[model samples]
Target: MAMVTFVDETTSGERRDALGLDIAEERLALRELIRRRVLEEAPDGDDTDRAYDRAVEAFGRNGFLVLVGDRQIEELDELVDLGPRTEVVFLRLVPLVGG
Candidate 1:
């Protein structure tokens, strides 16, 4: 298992081994990565389902930018090969006011 670092701009939070994900494979889908992240971070409660759904939606809507070791990922279905010390950053984009 490779060690990966996760950083989120939305919540300004950083997590290591967020979900104990096994990234030793040659490639990994972004969707699965997000799912694991949500599952790992979701709070246990009656509203856990709701929260998980919201998180998925956010990812689908491009609410955040995912970067793996300086490379920006464009699609949730994109496959990524993470390095041993890969750092993934989820940068939340804030919309600007109308001109």
Candidate 2:
């Protein structure tokens, strides 16, 4: 299993540490990765499904960008390879003021 650290960041340069995950597989689909993240955020609760649904919607609407190491993961179905000490960052893009 690999130890993966997750961080939440914004385009405005705000960053914070999120919960880490232990993944048994070296490779996982983007969708599965998102699912795991949601589960971590709200595990085994009634809100879990709702949270996951919201995450999916947010992803489809480009609410956040998932970056694994130096590469960006675009599609939910895409397969991502994780390293033993991988750092995944969820970057939230913000709109410019008065564009």
Per-candidate clashes, comma-separated: 0, 0
- Give lDDT: candidate 1, residue 95: 64
**What pairs collide in candidate 1?**
none
Tell me the tens digit of each residue's lDDT in model 2 across 1-99.
888888999988999989889999999988888889888878455688788889888888999999998899999999989889888888997877884
What range of 10 consecutive residues in model 2 has the weakest lDDT sum?
41-50
User: lDDT per residue, candidate 1, 33-68, as tens digits?
Assistant: 776666667777546567767766887787878889
The stretch of ten residues in a row with the least summed lDDT in candidate 1 is 11-20
Q: Which stretches of candidate 1 lie over 4 Å from their true place?
A: 10-26, 46-49
Q: Give the TM-score of each candidate.
A: 0.72, 0.90
Q: Best candidate per TM-score, number?
A: 2
